[model samples]
Target chain A: MDVFLQTLVAGILKGGLYALIGIGMTLIMGVMGIINLAHGQLMMVAMYITYVLHLAGVDPYISLFVAMPALFLLGCLIQRFLLNPLLKVDTILPENQVLMTVGIGMVLTEIIRFIFKSDYKSVSTGYSNATFFLGNISFSIALGISFIIAIAFTVAMFFFLIKTDIGRSIRATAQDKDAAVLMGVNTGRITIITFGLGSGLVAAAGCLLAPVYYVFPDIGGPFTARAFIITILGGLGSTVGAIFGGVTLGLAESFGATYISMDYENIIGMTIFVLVLLFLPGGFKRLTKI
Target chain B: MLKVDAIDVFYGDLQVLWGSSFEVREKEIVVLVGANGAGKSTTLKTISGLLRPKAGTIVFDGVRLDRLPADRIIGHGVVHVPEARRLFREMSVEENMVMGSLAPEARKKRRETLAWVYELFPRMKERRKQAAGTLSGGEQQMCAIGRGLMALPRLLMFDEPSLGLAPILVEDVFNIVKRINKEGVTVLLVEQNVRQTLALCDRAYVLENGSVVLQGTGKELLADPHVKEAYLGL
Candidate 1:
């Protein structure tokens, strides 16, 4: 029972950070109706930013603010210059925008490889190995802090989406672009902002993971696959579903690792994805509506 | 004041509007009544800047609306209430209304405008907290109109406002349009319900296969021999 409880706590903590990455990708997907394949590459960029800043004596947490806004502007430029222009082009495939993201992911990865030399790098603070004990379980202090900060950011995001005018416009644009335009929303501007918001969010998750995880150009591929799995499991374009999807994936992986084999963890995730696709086709969105 | 001058619109390689032109002066409830696929919706969509004309201009109060994007046209006080009541499905009724009040001045009077909208559509007020997708078709139409009103539009356009509603709800929609028209907002309505909309509108234009085949006052078109046989089924 103690082992089970310990696994549950750790899974939830890890899940919180996963939710941050999922939310960003989901936001971009929701508004644009296209999978942003470069999502994890964007996060990888932020991790490198954090890694560089950490070497300069900046805390990973402090560098979060800097990485987030920086990635936001980058995201805005990418959407405005790259993605939005695709809407006017008479491409052979409607999925040209989606394929463009794959190109973007490759470019981003190659650029990082050129700069960082394909080396595995990790950031370690003084408290990297610190732990806190409660009852019969122990929690890593850094993971706990990351979890709390992730939760804080999640709550802030919900508030922004629900209460702010720009947030409302984003939702409106996501729901129906034509209606949003008729309602006087600058949907073009909203799309750019939403992409920025999505990038900024993933940057937060990247910074949070930098202290405990390895940073490399190729790490993005696996995380990108993981992000999409979570998105599919939760339901495409559902932010609330992303939280449930992230936590479910987290718990499944942790339990699979502890009970079965470490190799089976990803297999277990794939099983969950198949089950979700078969049984709950709309993801949790069909059940939760919002 | 709005002027659409010999505009030609297309959907990809197919032309949908061929030299379609019309005018709506301030405070007039103008109606464009046509058969299915007669380009009524396309005309409204063009006027609202959703679709740009290939070789003509849409000038509203001397500003070239065809030169602007759909979103920018809204800022110029031209709001298009789209067909099928395209309310933000995940958002609440009130949130949908709030989305409409995006202009600076509209944002300031959002509270008052919301109150007025709710007053006009009490059904919307009762379900203000409900997600818009869950509403019935008639209720959705009302919510769509209410949302359009929240924009405080100078020239409000409705595309098939009574498309899929019960007879009584259709009457309610016409009455709402009439009531709003009396309150100093010019309206351009697209509808297939030829008889009632002609009765309700100040002036009517008949569109046939992407061209304006007839134009006159509501009573004049209602009595025209060609309109009587082709549309009113009289």
Candidate 2:
């Protein structure tokens, strides 16, 4: 029973990080309708940035400021130069966006690997392994910090979308591009900004995960899979849905790993994803606030 | 003043507007009446910079506006309240209005313009916090127009604001158009509802199959034989 509780607690903490990562992916897709296959690669780049900053004697938390804006600008430029042209009309077929993004992802990964090498890197924070106990379940300080930061970022993003003028334009463009332009919204600019903001969030996630997850040039693949699964499970374009979906998946994985063979955890997760797609194509729409 | 002088717009290989010339003098309401595909909406789209004319130009306040992007066009005091009441449906009514004043210059005037928009559509003030998607069709139309008004347009172009509204609501909307004009905002209205459109404008243009087939004062166009037969249904 104690073991089960411990696993459950661990899963919930991990789920918070998943939510942090999934927020960017979900926002980019839901609002922009663009599946950024390069998203995982962007996160990988962010992790590399964090590693470099740590090597230079900067704290991971402080590195977030540099990484977020830098990644944001990179995202904006990528959308403006590479993705924007592809977005207009379908040069590629329906499923080709994924392939195109995958190609771009490979390029980004190779470049990062060439610059930084493919060796494993991890952040050694001051409270890297410190933990707090609540009864029999123990939670690491890093996990707790990640969870708090993730929730705060999510709330801030929500407030920005609902409260600001520019935020309204972003939401409007997301819903109806033509209409938004008609109303004098520079949708092209909005698209670029959305891309920047999405990648910026991913940078923060990268900084958070550097201490916990093993980072490497090709480490984005499994992270990409996790992000894709969480996004789909939460429904495309829903931030709150991403959080709920991430937590649910984390719990399921934790329980499955304990009761069943740990090796079959991937199978169980994939099965739930498939079932969700089959049953609820919209993905937890009832749970969405608006 | 908004002048679309002999402009030709094409959708790829197909010509959508041919030598389409019209003018809306400051503070006057000009109506474009036509069938579904007569290019009324396309004309609005071209003027708003959504569709660039392959040939000719658009001038507002004696300045060429043909080269500017849609959002930049709003800075020139020409705003388009598109067809279908394209309010940011998921967002609140207030947010939709705020989005209208997106240009950096317009942001300076937002508070005053917002006050005017709310004054124009008082019901919107009551439902300001409500999601625009849930508003009634007539209310949504009001929200859409109110949003355009938030830009403080010198010339407000409305494409079928009467669409999907009750007859009484249509009358109310046209009355608001007249009121907006009287308040010194020039109006260019496009509508399939020929009778109501004719009843509301100083001048009218009849477009057919992407060309301006007839042009006259509102009363003249209203009494023309072709307009009477095809548009007025008399």
**DockQ, all candidates in order:** 0.82, 0.73
Among these predictions, the greatest DockQ belongs to 1
Compose the digit string of candidate 2's lDDT tens values, residues B5-74: 8989999889989898888887788999889988999999998888999888788977788888777888
Clashing pairs in 2: A30-A237
Task: Summarize candidate 1's per-residue lDDT along B124-147 as a digit string, tens digits.
Answer: 999999999999999999898888
Point out where model 1 deviates above 4 Å.
Answer: none
How far residue B106's Cα lies from its native spot in candidate 2, in Å, is: 3.3
For model 2, fnat equals 0.82
Least lDDT summed over 10 consecutive residues: which range in candidate 1 chain B?
B68-77
Query: Model 2: per-residue lDDT, tens digit, A97-204?
Result: 567678878998999889988888788888888898889778888878887887788789888877887777787888888888877778888888988998998888
Candidate 1 residue lDDT tens string, A221-245: 8788778888987789989999988
